[model samples]
Target: MRMKKTTTAAIGAAALLSGLLTLAGAPAAHAADGCNNDNGRTVRTAFGGKGQGFELRVNGSGNSTCAWGRIVGGAPGMHVWVDRSSDGGRTWEPQLGWAEISSGGSIWTEAWRDSNGRLMRACGDSGYNTAITCTTWY
Candidate 1:
């Protein structure tokens, strides 16, 4: 009876550990859950190379005054981001918001507030050594 109880305890411990690891590996929810298209719009789009078959988008909401990046029709491992600038595209910080397609055709980055005269644009790469492409600032 003692041996049976020990085995049962071991199995329970293993199951608990497996559940904890799965939760740790899962992606976290976006911080701007409500800042999506339902509350915003696609401000601009950046098309990649004709053969690359990828488009990067800058999405924003006038009411929320926030922006994010989205990549559509890209293979897994491709990358997308939103860039922000105060002076224009000529000089700006890179990858203000970003996301990678882990196993899907599309993905979007976390939203960022576009206040204080900030300008935003979308950019992406084929993730196979292709050059990065970006859209006009908006």
Candidate 2:
């Protein structure tokens, strides 16, 4: 199966949630709490690829590094975009220009770098809104 580029209707929320999933691993097929909602973007990188990335940590209510993430229960049409590059952040492919939040009243997200300089991001829903936010990448 291929990962299609999808856009959520919620807007800013989508970006936040996408960040959560990327940083926290939302368990698309199974349940994995290993990536639960956490505090402000914490970064940790173990010897994996080239050995230089990190694990993002996020929290709800006030810890946000990106836009549209300072408040909870954002207005309708809230969302975000993502960009990535295998060349070490020099050039990035517009992963998801923008997406919306489907569910969850509150959310938190985190981001970090990997050993190979590959970017890793994650985010999670807190209120459990349930709109099914998605991501799109090239």
Candidate 3:
């Protein structure tokens, strides 16, 4: 009778520990959720070289906007940037610089505010090549 009780208790403890470990290893929930396009707008543009391309996401809310860039394929040494224009693309802010996507595939994001009635642009360059392509988000 004592052996039976000890075996049952061990099983119960193992089950409880398994449940706790699963919960502890779970991923945390996001705080801001996702970009709310209901009160705002979103645009996606494609750029890059032949087999290697990139997509840009422009999420705009009120006078604020966030831009994100992601590599579509295995593009090595690819770099991109986001530029802001307050005067309907007549002029643009300084190039926000370039970022190379990580090997594990992570997206690059930038945010700016007080850009009401302005425009956002995503540009990309393939390594040392001087040629570039840009897309505007209104």
What overall lDDT goes with each candidate model?
0.70, 0.33, 0.57
Winning candidate number (TM-score): 1
Which residue ranges in model 3 land beyond 4 Å of their true spot? 1-42, 102-106
TM-score of each: 0.63, 0.28, 0.56
- Name the weakest run of 10 consecutive residues (lDDT summed) in model 3: 29-38
Write the residue-wise lDDT of candidate 1 on 84-124 in tens digits. 77786577767755678899778877776665677878788
Q: What tens-digit string does per-residue lDDT give for candidate 3 at 1-138?
A: 999999999999999999999999763422123443233233666655544555556565564555544455535566666666678777776445357655643345444442457666667666666467666554
Pairs clashing in candidate 3? none
Off by over 4 Å in 2: 1-73, 96-99, 102-115, 119-138
Following a full C-alpha superposition, what root-mean-square deviation does model 3 have from the true structure? 10.9
Residue 41 accuracy (lDDT) in model 2:
42
Query: In model 2, what lDDT does residue 106 have?
Result: 27
Q: What C-alpha lDDT, on a 0 to 100 scale, does residue 5 get in candidate 3?
A: 100
Query: What's the residue-level lDDT of 97 in candidate 2?
Result: 24
- List, residue by residue over 1-138, the lDDT tens digit for candidate 2: 123323344666788889988978643222123423335443321211222121233333222222111224443334433344467556654422233445543233322222234443322222235332222211
